[model samples]
Target chain A: MPTIRDIARLAGVSVATVSRIINHSGKVRPETEKKVKQIIQETHYQPNQVARTLYQKRSKMIGIVVPNLNNTFYAQVIDGIQSVLQKNNYSALISFSTSSDGSKYLEAIDNFKNNNVDGIITSAFTPPANWNPTTPLVMYDSADIQDKIVRISSDNSKGGQESVKLIAKNVKKVLVQHWPLSLPTIRERVEAILKELNRQNIAYVLEEVSESDPYLAAQQALNKRNTFDAIITVNDPYAAEIIKEAKRRGVNIPKDFQLVGYDNNILCEYTDPTLSTIDQQPHLIGQTAATRLFKMMAGDTSTNNDIINVIPIKRNSTY
Target chain B: MPTIRDIARLAGVSVATVSRIINHSGKVRPETEKKVKQIIQETHYQPNQVARTLYQKRSKMIGIVVPNLNNTFYAQVIDGIQSVLQKNNYSALISFSTSSDGSKYLEAIDNFKNNNVDGIITSAFTPPANWNPTTPLVMYDSADIQDKIVRISSDNSKGGQESVKLIAKNVKKVLVQHWPLSLPTIRERVEAILKELNRQNIAYVLEEVSESDPYLAAQQALNKRNTFDAIITVNDPYAAEIIKEAKRRGVNIPKDFQLVGYDNNILCEYTDPTLSTIDQQPHLIGQTAATRLFKMMAGDTSTNNDIINVIPIKRNSTY
Candidate 1:
């Protein structure tokens, strides 16, 4: 309940000194800061964030739009964002917009704008054609938008190329399973893989899989007439299901068929053959996005879009 | 930049009617409401949330304190909470405080209070002794707190008892690997297991493992003794590691040693033998907590603390 004036009076310092200490803007003597802090703590003085936001037109809050929290990848990315946001004395308002219809995504954006967030970080949701937002928007993994919006993503194309190069060594025929290519990020990886395979003249079969029911997709892929000496999956979960189903059908990994997956999730290390995967470094992607958003908010216009490189982790799944 | 007065004047209504319609507080004529809404949309009217918060002393924001985001259980719970919060037009401010020392927990509490969150839902972190918060506090998976604090937890004791009873059916000598029982939830499970084991007169040995490194604990547990016919793990990740390590050592599960794990995560089905675990229903826990918090905020004093039921999932490891 104690205001800045009360803290100043109690600490025997000017109100300007109190404001400086609270905002860390203007310079104040170390002794004066210490005294003001002690008084503020003793009196349990909480700065009125509502009033401050009204006066400065800044909420010190950032909005994060994640597709799904059940995915460890997104959760870890959020963790990375929070780590940076906490250090900078900012709060993150998280909203889950899992629908690809763009309605929920637009609603979340509108809600953030209504709350007057300083910035927004969204993962893998393309805006509608008629939508336009004035807020500083940072897209994470949802690329190919307008040039004005800042985009941050892992180098999925490179990851795809490296995966093909790795699998091309031992197998003549490879099965590549992917989700819908409607997502620009997934399309980038798919195109890169196809280009590399064509350049290498490797024989490969591409199959589309449902992201929701990857296990069924794996089963359907296996039931197809074409036999593959090796398999590459869009993500770890699909690869895991393939490995399990393949084992059920008496096919051995590495000996009969090699396997590779993207998104080096923890399951990659625990799978039967210990999956080989491309590590996209989701945490790093999140941290980079937050850092770039902060820089942009701080009037650093030179902060350009970034693409984090992915690393190929080889385990027993592949030679 | 259109104010409430502008929208009201354009719609031929008073400012108070616009405010009531916006806040959904008081009754307004249907025709007037529709006209005001149309004009507000046309003019792109966004109410100043900061000003409204200052005036009404309510932000319609709830804070969630999670210890770790990498864990899928917590992520699923958060998803459930967000689903409800979004439906109610409330925002979730999430904070991660991984330390058990309680400093980060207290800091998150302080930050949430400063931001004027209507309530807080924390996952398994005990509040500092000297701390007293008047805001509605909900403890998720943390029981035995103050009388006023609402606690929402799965019936860990029941889950533990069921696990022990199941394992005792096939094996006499059992090994139980758990995290530090210092956590109230873990303690409940451990105590229940021990009590049941005693009642059945089944010999058992208990070992504490690091939650961060379950694989090492599994290896150490395996190295410590090689005679147990059954093993009970604290969670799925530890069970997955134990299964993988046991396979490495040429130990067959179910044929040689039965295994049971807690928190039936998604990885449970992907494990080689497929893990048998206690399903804590994290989604229901989250939903229940949010529902109770909303009720409490609505001045429902009779909202009692709840204990969600846990079910034992039968899988290859146990059967």
Candidate 2:
């Protein structure tokens, strides 16, 4: 590894100057730092991490608080953000708070802050509106924060509307599958879906089950046999369970009953009739979230903290 | 947070000795270090991270390399390990390498090494026979590295057998979705599956797809419209694609064909038939990998690095 001294010599600067530039130490002329950086890049010199940590006095880490890593949606988003962060040499401290309450989320965030994380990406429920961390913060799909913090999410309303419209076109009586409206985002989706069905004059049953909890959702859905012509799920996995149980009862999708799910997760494409699902462009959402976080950390204060919505992707589930 | 003085008083050590122990300085005796750690635990005194970094010159960061983060099998495994790492102060540098070639894998490993990462978690193709690292290492789904490293994986042979039996019961003609046996693990699975099928007096077609890509495998299978009755995919996502395409062509599952997938990924559940899939227990495997890495780092030199087989879980896709 080329030491700072080697780069300093190559750039005609003292080792002290090189260190100053690398650590963003006070008052090195911008032109001089640029020249040093040029030489460092050319030499493929990766600063010795051990020495840099000592000088920077900060862990170049982003504290990422996700609700459920087992959930496919959050998992994909984390993968996306991690991909970008890896390129920037920033490590992610990922914490999965599968707990229903916000206590673990708060603890994870507080702990990460104590660890001197450079920034934080967390769910909205974890931190109070008045809460402020030493580092930068961003929220993913949180409505409670409103316009207070950077928020990234897909168009849940549009997704719900589209799924409703799909069901309206194909089936007469449909059962909208869902978990309890635990999050405001899910509630918004449920509302939008109902509104769309009303607008279309499509007769539907609002089957409110604990769809997010896989075991309960499957068991509950199984208990209700032959009630509707189709079922629309809040998310893809829940849709999977409904379809499986429906099949066990000899219910045929798009034949005896149509099935549609939201979030065209990888699983959506694999279902027997290939579930028609409303898409949130999960990968793009990930890319957008990371880029937005980077921009905020880079001192973009004017960014509207209001929900930034991603467009829905229509797939086989609708048709 | 409590300062070193408080810890020193608690441990009956001098202020300077406490500093050395908490900062990971070599001058402090091991016994003193242990005492300091205990005090830290009892008090829950998370030191100023900035101060800790200044003295230790280490960030306690680790790196993880997965073949594809989008793949649920790997994603679940990552979730399991990340659950533990997040609790500790270790941040993870996550990366995905497309090629299974050891060079791409090595590139990621070297990145972690150069970053002064405390350890590594790699979903390796085939781990090196005597791979040793200055930092701790954990290998997932890799085998035959002697007792020098940690390895975690599902029983591919058993997964294969379970899949075949599941498919055979429903469909007389089954298609084994796979690529050429370049890897011994893949070869073992293929052989075990054929052996089981032969014993069952089943007539199966070995549909060898040249590409290991999921979409390609699905497309190739789709092209053979009536070539098979039941489709067994190499992985969950691959099985998903077959189901999607088969449905697009109006082929009803269980009516026209039976479908089974491996990796019992969330995709299996979301699929229309709720995918009869072989669950590889990725979560348990991931936890094991992290635990083993800790052991290896703590100077455990006698871990069995042979293939650690986890049982496959059966889900809805089968009969």
Candidate 3:
């Protein structure tokens, strides 16, 4: 096994230059980098990451916490994060919370701290009363209410307004299907929807639904089909279920009622009538969060919240 | 911060016992383990994982390389891997190989080796001529042809037979829609399908399609709707796209032609006529691969190829 010193001697470069090239930290000329990399490849010189971490006090690992992988949304977010991590030559230690609880987030953070990770990026979770920020942390899919923590959030207010505009054109009474409003992200969107509805003088009613069973939620939402002229679903999957259920119930989508959904999921384009939804660009959100975390890890102590804009996709489901 | 020695002293246990508890190695009484954990938590004793890795020559990390996260199949597999790792106190270092090239896989393996991962689990890829097995590796979604490497493969041969059976009941001519058959896994399934087709005296024509654009593939396949009585798609998403295209051309599924697909994806139920496909149970495959890797890491060097069974899902797309 060739050591870093051997690589430096072979390439006629200083050890610090080789270290910069290996860590992807400092700038190196393209020709020098290419020449050194070719030699490293030829020699098969493997860097001992464990010893390097011990000496530098940086693990070059980022801890990431996602809610779950079942939803393509989170998967896209992880993909985006990976895009950045790979570019920076950093590895990710990921934990799937699987449930909406703060305990798992805390445990993951503690584990990352024990590993001496460079930084942490996690999804939305309420911090405990005794919360302390000892490491650079970035939160996404959050409401951006923490006093000292940086956050990356989707522009839910704009999405909510877009949803109303999509359906309110030909709607009278609209039924809004939703999950728990205790979630600050959901509340932000719902509040924006209500304000827009009031501004447009559209009569609307909020219907709480079960997130676990979108099919059953669709059935319940459709049971009031005769009363409402339009329906706004919790998300794309729920909207897809509503379309399936409507087809079975002999209900025409845009004729009987209009429909709109959040999270422009991939299923949107495949549905029979094609769904109208909000494009949150979850991939961009993940990339932004990771980029910000790296900036903070580089000694930028500024705490701020960033918002990625949303786009409204109109399709056959809307009039 | 409290040290491990302090925790062991307070719990009236030896340093080795405390070390075993922290590393999740060896055996300890339930009460003693609980008492020690409680004290450690209360005292905020964070284990130094970097130092531990230096001393133990084990990182307690697993490197995972998947093709991509765009498909829900890979996501489900990662979820399953996480389930096993969470219980055993292991963290996953994941790299998403977005492209089909073998170079990304090689790079990932080199990085994982540099980081000293305890083991590795990767999707199908061709190894170089001078490949050496210096680390424990388990391959999934691959042909079990590697000499010393353990592989977990879905019973693709059985899946192919099931696909033939699903559409063979009332079919004369079949259009087999597929991507590049150069891939070993796809070739395995195609061989079985051809065998089953010959056994049933069914006439079949292989139609190569573009995986990057499924909608266009649907259009191309539908152009031959008059010549074939059934179409077997590469996967569920492609099947769903065929359904959408057929609806546009006023071709009723199971009427104009029967359809069967591979991978009973989430789109199966949401498709208009539903998709009759093969269930690969990717989650179970992931769990099995991780479990086998752990066994190998425990000094069980027996190499055996495991095949997880596939199921034929009966849905409305077939007669």
Best by lDDT: 3
Q: Please give the lDDT score at residue A164 for candidate 2.
A: 76
Ten residues in sequence with the least summed lDDT for candidate 1 chain B: B141-150
Reference-based lDDT, each prediction: 0.84, 0.71, 0.89
Error at A284, model 3, angstroms: 0.9
Docking class of 3: medium
lDDT of model 3 at position B207: 86
**Candidate 1 per-residue lDDT over residues A1-319, each given as its tens digit:** 8898899999887877887788788788898889899999999888877666765688889999998888788987898888889889898888888787777888888888877899999976656565556887788876544466688978878988988976877678888888788878888899999899889888889988887998897788678625878888888988899888888998788788788998899899888989999998988989998999998888776536788889999999998
- Candidates 1 and 3 compared: the better one by DockQ is 1
Cα RMSD, each candidate: 2.8, 5.6, 4.1
DockQ of 3: 0.74
By TM-score, how accurate is candidate 1?
A: 0.93
Model 3: which residue pairs collide?
Answer: none
The ten-residue window of minimal lDDT in model 3 chain A covers A142-151
Model 2: pairs clashing at backbone N, Cα or C within 3 Å: A179-A211, A270-B240, A271-B271, A271-B272, A272-B272, A276-A316, A276-A317, B275-B317, B276-B317, B276-B318
Ranking by lDDT: 3, 1, 2
Model 1 bad stretches (over 4 Å): A4-21, A25-42, A128-132, A144-146, B5-17, B26-39, B129-131, B144-146
- Those runs of model 3 whose alpha carbons end farther than 4 Å from true positions after fitting are A1-44, B1-43
Q: CA lDDT of B261 in candidate 1?
A: 87
Candidate 1: tens digits of C-alpha lDDT, residues B223-264: 854678899988988889889888888888888889998888
